[model samples]
Target chain A: MTSSTTESEFGESRESDSDNPSVTKVARSKLSIALAAVFCLSVIMGTGPGVLLVNRPESISGIPLVYAWGILWYFVQVAVVIVASLTVWRSTGVAESCRTHNAPSRPERNSAERGEGELPR
Target chain B: MTIPILVVLIYLGVLLLFGWLGYRRGERSEEDYYLAGRGQGWFISAMTIMATFFSSFALLGAPGMVYREGLVFALVSLNVPIAGVAIYLLGNPIRRAGKRGGYITQADMLCDHYGDGVGLRLLVALVGFLFAIPYVMMQLKAGGELAAVLFSGYDHAFEAGAIVLSVITALYIMIGGMRSVAWTDALQCALLVMGMALGGISLVVSMGGPSAFLHEVNQLPTSSLTVPGNTGFWQLPMLFTVCLLMPIGGIIQPAQWMRFYSARDADTLRRSALIFSVLLTGCFIFAIMPIGLGGQVMYPLELSADGVAPNERVGSFDQILVVMLDDLMPRLLGEVAGATLSSLVIVAIMAAAMSTADSNLHALSALFTRDIYSRFLRRGCSEREKLWSGQLLIFVATAFSLVLVLIGSRPESSLSGLMQMIVTLALFAVAFSIQLLPMTLDVLFIGRGTRNAAIISLSCGLLVAFCFTPLFPLLFAKESSPLILWINAAKELIPMHASAWGLVVNGLVFVAVSVIESRVLKARSV
Candidate 1:
């Protein structure tokens, strides 16, 4: 299953080398690792022990202290997601080309990748 | 009859116009109708996504909760940001898969990944329907409640309002489907934000300024300003459970899942996450929080003799913002201007409800058409037959929802009890939606689970979730099942939400079942 499926199977053509399945796989795996790390960090900061940091009885700038703390993290998350989307998710020339071309050749590629229209067993 | 009613009428007219426009642009193809040809830009996608996510719950329910519970409800608002993160982490990959697979619904990708087992497709469709109907009902109830208050003098106003809103919403979606839904949602999102900001600002100015508002809030009891909050319902354990699970559930629900499939590319969704996070946080803090805290000051909680504060509630907690808008806008702006602004706020409330309802209804239609009807009722139906079937289901769902809303609007209906029941059902829907998460993770990112594992794990997870719900108790003869005692014990021990508890079982069963199935398959191959 692992060999059969790779990030290249999902139309993420980074480095203009979508033709090279091996390179696309390596890039996608690295992107996956980076996303995983960010996700873990968000979980920690947004909900886990990070919640403890805001579970308090105070106020800042007239807002409840805890609410103020939560808002700060909210901004941090917004920054992080924007950074990730611009950088890690679309990090190559092929991605740039795909966007520019509006992915005109997507339907044929998608059908080939998905193997739809199969007879029901 | 009134200014607010007129404003709402005008708003409805604009929505119809958008529907007509969408109808003009729509093609006969399924993808064109369901996903707007998957060419949405960042702004439209962001606004539509945000609009669909907010619902009447954000506009009406959250502030009311804050009024009842205090700042802890504000903490719960942080869940919006977590959902934004989910959009980035979960949605981006899903979009990639969607693009690769030409997927239109949650079941489409899942059935493709696991091979089209009829049972798997049906289960996914059932979950989507169950999750969607309550949400549609919630928004319908909201519309009725808005009408009930805004046109208090008229008899049967609530039912009339609910029926009207339902018909109009269903009509628009029927006219142009997802295109009309998304385009109208973008406009509704803008109005929602502005309305919230206007309400907050109106209150602040009426009370002097932000500092004065804060000073008033500071004068309130210390309990209202801290964790554990008003009646102690926002205790850490419950808060932790809600903050963790509900956001993820909110994001991964069927409507949102389809939104992931509709994105033009990763950049559109990425930009959407950024916009959504900022807009929600701003509206939550600067707009929503003030109405709640201001309500506490305006209508202080009633106390008992012992002063234990048995419940964190006020007579009309849910109506605080609406009531405040009615009162403050008039005093602050005077006659014509005040009435106009109030009318706009009322329209905004309607927008909030309608945006959520349309998305849920649209997703439900797609789920029925693609997953169930095509699979069983008519396997080789033309695109026209499928489209018409999906369109018919919208009215079916809406009519059923309207009947429930009317029944709940009766004088004998316990408004508080009904609200509580609706809330519980809605939460239960989310719990069921979250069960799809493990399977989704497996299909999109991790390719480990087998077909049998997906089917069994989903069944077990949904069953466990149902058992943990409050509905489980009602199912018994005396409303006191054996499960009640165990649920009570579990709550006493951990104070966790049913969604959280269900998820523990869900993950464990999913991983365990997958391992067993995988081992069996390996042995068979050997």
Candidate 2:
């Protein structure tokens, strides 16, 4: 059941790139990796120890250095989210696929049956 | 007085009307009521998510922290965007799982993943209850605080305000369910954004605009402009841990977990992630941050031997924003306009409080009904029966939180000792919710945790987190006990937030137990 669900969710993406599945797969994988890297970097610089480097009394453009540091990282994080949303999250046929493949056949009748097991990987 | 009262009444009436509309539009199914048929759009999803993520904490507590702590909280505000990022990274998968499996509560999805056991379900539900009640109490307390300021001349204004807010919020969720809650959240989100912008602008203008405001802020004591802040609370380790964990903790709490379930699709959450990060961060940075700095410049805290305290004009740290609006709006904009603007901003603050209260109450109802009542109390209950039970739970939970808030509000009451800044309550609540994080990540991504592991780990996490809360000594430990002394020393040495501490223990326990359980199962099979 889990394998079937996974197949259905990713099946459309495969079909959309059937002409060159390997290239598209590699590209998507690379983009996801890059996005994750950027996100991690932003978190480190924005809120982690990177903040200590800039935590000072001095002002940047009249804003406190730490605050200005936060704002810069905020934009970086926002950019990462936007790029990921438009690229990796933008599946070819997710809405239709999710509806057909993901929707329960009927309302779950019992607690044991409801949310029956782990999600498709 | 008339203007503020009138404004509150009108705002509340609209919220009730939305609740009624949601009732009229809703189907009688449990999913329809609890998850809004899992069809919330990007706009409503984003707004409701934002509105729920922020609470009076955003308006009152955050600025209060900034006012008291200085620029330190401005850095703390960065947590909002991290939460935004989580919406897509964490939320999308959760949504996909929820849609596929027809899950309504956090416990449902989690129990499903860990292979449902009564103990695991109960523990998960307990976590939800613990998170919801304190959070609900905080929102109710905000209402009381607002009323005390807005209706200062009236006797028992605080009590009246809290009761009204609680009753109204409960009624709406009881009537409209998720639809009404989400719609009202949308309107409240708009009001909150407007209020933040307007409040910031008024403060800046009153200080003679941007340059003058910056100059005044710059002139504040060096402590107010640097790390550890005015009170020395936000040390580097504390700030780093809080910024790292609080948002993750906030995003996985019961109310937000259901929001992920309610989202229409992956795209809805994807869009919500972007909007949430961009719009909320903008509001916090531009609008909310200034209010705190301006508060320091306008109404400076008293520096005493004990520590810095709020100015005489300000009743408490949380009251700083309300006091600023009351004093500045009237003085800056003339009598009629200032009062009107003040009323609107007050309503916005109330909106922030109500939006959160309604979501938690609604989510609590679902948690009780789906996770506990139907499963344990009455198996195979009708959909209508479950729905009715959920609604009743909302009313009962609201009353319970109201009573707790009222008790805490009393000066002589022991519970009053527990009540501090709104942010403190928020962090306390988040500590409990953060216990779910290790399990949630495993269920969503890692898929290695056992049911026994989840239960044991969550219990340990909750215990450790509770020890860090202010209520620990009040309830269990004597003030002078070796245990209390050691805990305090540990806290002072580490300086991490309660949520981080809990997550650290929770994550470690979860991994260790899972590994051990897996090994045991493998040996038995062999």
Q: Which candidate has the top score in lDDT?
A: 2
The per-prediction tally of clashing pairs is 0, 0
lDDT of each: 0.77, 0.86
Error at B449, model 1, angstroms: 0.4
Stretches of candidate 2 off by over 4 Å are A1-19, A92-121
Tens digits of per-residue lDDT for model 2, B151-219:
889899999999999999999999999999999999999999999999999999999989999988888
Model 2 over residues A1-121: C-alpha lDDT tens digits? 1122223333333234335656766897899899889878877777677777876688878877767887888788778877877777765325345455624322222233544544321
Residue B155 shift from truth in candidate 1, angstroms: 2.6
Q: Give the residue spans of candidate 1 off by over 4 A.
A: A1-56, A60-62, A92-121, B305-315, B409-418, B421-426, B475-479
Once model 2 is optimally superposed onto the true structure by TM-score, how far is the C-alpha of residue B163 displaced, in angstroms? 0.9
Native contacts recovered by candidate 1, as a share? 0.30
lDDT of 1 at B421: 29
The DockQ score of candidate 1 comes to 0.24
TM-score, chain B only, every model? 0.95, 0.98
TM-score of model 2 vs. true structure: 0.93
